[model samples]
Target: MKRNSYAIIGSGALGGLYGGMLAKAGFDVHFLLNSDYQHVSEQGLKVQSTWGDFHLPQVNAYDNAAAMPACDVTIVALKTVRNHLLPDLLPATTREGGVVLVLQNGLGVEVESAAIVGEDRVLGGCCFLCSNKVGPGHIHHMDFGRIVFGEYSRQEITPRAQTICDELNSANIDAQVSADLGAVRWRKLMWNIPFNGLSVALNASTKEIVDTPSSFALADAIIREVHQGAAACGVDVPESAIAKTMGNTVKMVPYDSSMRIDYLNGRPMELQAILGNPLAAAKASGHEMPRVEMLYQSLQFMDKAAGK
Candidate 1:
């Protein structure tokens, strides 16, 4: 398998977790840090994982994307709230024919990323990852660190995709390629729509939300709504998606959702991409998502209340 230098645009929890794994495996991974640049530069990244704990004493960290050399594969882990910076981040770090992988939560993300990096060079990745950054250069991995990748156009796995899978798997991160991008996107949403929203609205952790019967029911309802939205968009997501996601949540480590953490930090949550984008796609296909609509509207209000 071939490995290329990797650049991470958002060096937060998701970025640090995956990129750190790659770097530990000897892949040249350049990190574009945010506010944590100084801390990470000083102490490097310390990862405490359920699987194992490791520390990288030093990393190639840069605050400016322009300073980072063009990479053959660039993984974007930016929150959709900061998606407006995608164009600014991609052009400088991705070379011609380089793969731009988006490890994000939401619908139609590939469309926007593809617009900037060309569809043929774009691959969509959905991470079933449970990890967080405790402090600058500090990460905690709770459970579940598998990643699923799909070609933007839903084609068979190409050599590039296989190479990517090989690289991640070499780093001990389970990686799979999906031939159905639409189904994969909606399947990821089955969990995101419910947990991300309820976590923020109810001010609780994953365990708290799933342990409560009422909240669990609410999550189920959102899952059903998401399933319907997927079907309306001509992607028939099986009921197994909901069942599998629920089963995972039941066994997941007690944790704060990314949205909940973002809200607590007074940052803008990704309500638009996770809620509004799918809702628009569903409505365009003549289907309405009442449960998800309520969640979306409530998140909008909560976002405003947070002054983000």
Candidate 2:
């Protein structure tokens, strides 16, 4: 496979993890980072992963999209709260059909990306990794790391997608291309629906939320509501799948959720994408998600109180 230049829109934890690893593999990866961390790229990126530590010497970094060169694939890993800012990152310096991977956490990515870059060039993907930025030029992987995606609009699967899969697999990343990406995304949402909000509400880790009786019950209720909501939207999400998602919460112990981390740092929460979107879909399908609606209302109330 021919190597391609990769541009990462968000240089935070998730983007840094994938972008740094790709650059280490000798793909021409450029991270559109904040100006503060641009100096680290002058030398190179310092990736601290569970796989190993790497001081990639050949990594390219940029602070703005204008500085990036033509690329084959562009990874969008920004938080759901900043989904509106995506227009600034699309339209990369690449051919018309260049691959655009949406590595976001919620369901609206494909819809959102298609509006900006058109459906033909967009692919729906989800990251199954847990990572956080520990410092400038550094990302700490908390647990599992892999990515799965598929074309959502019946567009031809670009060689760039297969090449990226091979690259990630070669690096020991358990990457896969989903045959039914909507199902894959709904599965991912099963986990995010409960954990993301409960973690923020309790100010606790995933393990803590699952271990305690009250929090565990809250988590279960939220999952049930989400499953019903998904079914209402004509998505065939199984009850067994919902249980497995909750079970993984215990496995992902010691890991703080994205919402919890955002709340801790006083950043604006992604309640809309994480909670509101699913609730809206459920309502649109004439489904009642009382538990999720409660949680969503509480999060919105909290956000308003925090002046966020």
Candidate 3:
């Protein structure tokens, strides 16, 4: 078996967890860090996972992409708001013929990546992860670490996609290859839309929102609207997905969403990618998600008011 070397573009919570797991499995993994560069370079990476706690004493850490070696696979885990850096980071860290896997949330995320790396060399990954970067060089994995990914523009699970899935599974990470990228992305949005948006809007955690009747009802309505929007865009998301998402949330440990964390930390939120793009797509398909649009506007207002 050919082991693929990996370049982790955003060495934050998601990137650190996945890349740390790969590195722990003995694959060559290069991490590109920003603010944590100094800390990680000196102390290495730390992972506090539900499965166990481990640390990599020595790691291939680089502060700049140009200083890192091009690798077989480049996993992008940066927030959507920082996607502007992909154009430079993708080409710099990806070797020729290598693929780029986007592990961020939202609809049409692969579009920009594909435009830079070509559609065939790009894959979209929908991550069901509950983890956070507690401090420099430290990641805390709470629960759920499954990734469903597929080619950006293809309907078949290509060999490249399967290979990545196999590698992830080998590292004890639950990974699966999907046949339809669009459908998978929309299905993931069934949870992201309500939980991520309402978490900040209502100033609550996943359990708080689910435990409250009014908030839970709002979340349910938003999920239905996302299902309608997906249908309008020619994607068939099963109606049963609504119950599944709600049930899953009800069981998940009380955790703060990425969006809520960003807002509370006074950082920019991913309004354009998460809300703006999906709303535009639905509107173009002659569907209107009123609840989603209202949430979008409210979030925008809050973001501006906080100067984030």
Candidate 4:
């Protein structure tokens, strides 16, 4: 595969992890770092992951979309709460046939993004990693850093997705093209809805939540609710999926979820996208999501307190 120029939108955590690795692997990578633009320009990007510590010296970091170069591929790694803000960040580079890879958290991001950019140009992806920004130019990757991307609604897989998969695999990253992107996304969402929100609501870690009986039960219940909700949306998640996800979560080194981190940092939490989308699906499918509803209400209460 020929190397391609790549643009990263919302270059934080997952963005930094994937983008930094790609840049390190010698791809012509540019990052739209709106929040850390100035800092990255002055100091470059500092990524500290289990893989190693990397300081990118020649990276193209931009705050405004207008400053970015037209690219073959664009990765949308923004938090779900910031989905509405993406149209203004596209610049001219993302239009036409350029593939927009949605490597975001939450369930309906593909739909939301396809609504803005045409469905044909949008691809769905999920990052099987835990990472966050620790400082202006530094990202702390806490766990696995695999990135899986593929076609969502389009008939043939776009060239951009194929090229990216090749580059990522060449670099020893866990990257693959799945036939069912919707199922892949819903599978990830099934784990996030309960674990992420409940961690935030109780100010607890995954391990802590799992160790406590009441919290553990709550987490299990929320998992069941999310499974039913996915079924309502036509995604069938088996009963054992929750237990498997919990096992994976337990393997990660101790770290707080992005929701809890956002809550602590006084930023707007991503409760709406993380929990709201699935709950909306459940309601639309005429399924009751009492456990998810309670968790969503709890997040709302916390958001109000945070003035988000």
lDDT score at residue 80, model 2, on the 0-100 scale: 71
Better of 2 and 4 by TM-score: 4
> Which rank order by TM-score, best down to worst?
3, 1, 4, 2
Q: Estimate each model's TM-score.
A: 0.97, 0.93, 0.99, 0.94
Instruction: Find the candidate with the highest lDDT and give its number.
Output: 3
Off by over 4 Å in 1: none
> Cα lDDT for residue 20, model 2?
78
Deviation in Å, model 3, residue 25 alpha carbon: 0.2
Worst ten in a row by lDDT for model 2: 154-163
Q: Which should have the higher TM-score, number 2 or number 3?
A: 3
Which digits, one per residue and each the tens of the lDDT, describe model 1 over residues 117-137?
A: 889889998988888889988
* Residue 86 shift from truth in candidate 1, angstroms: 1.8
Clash pairs, candidate 4, are none
Q: What is the lDDT of residue 305 in candidate 3?
A: 100
Worst 10-residue lDDT window for candidate 3 reads 107-116
> Candidates ranked by lDDT, best first?
3, 1, 4, 2
Query: Which regions in candidate 3 have their CA more than 4 angstroms from the true location?
Result: none
lDDT pick, better of 1 and 2: 1
Q: What is the lDDT of residue 205 in candidate 1?
A: 94
Can you write out model 3's per-residue Cα lDDT over 111-204, one digit (the tens) per residue?
8789899989999989999999999999999999899999988899998889999999998888999999899899999999999999999999
Candidate 1 residue pairs that clash: none
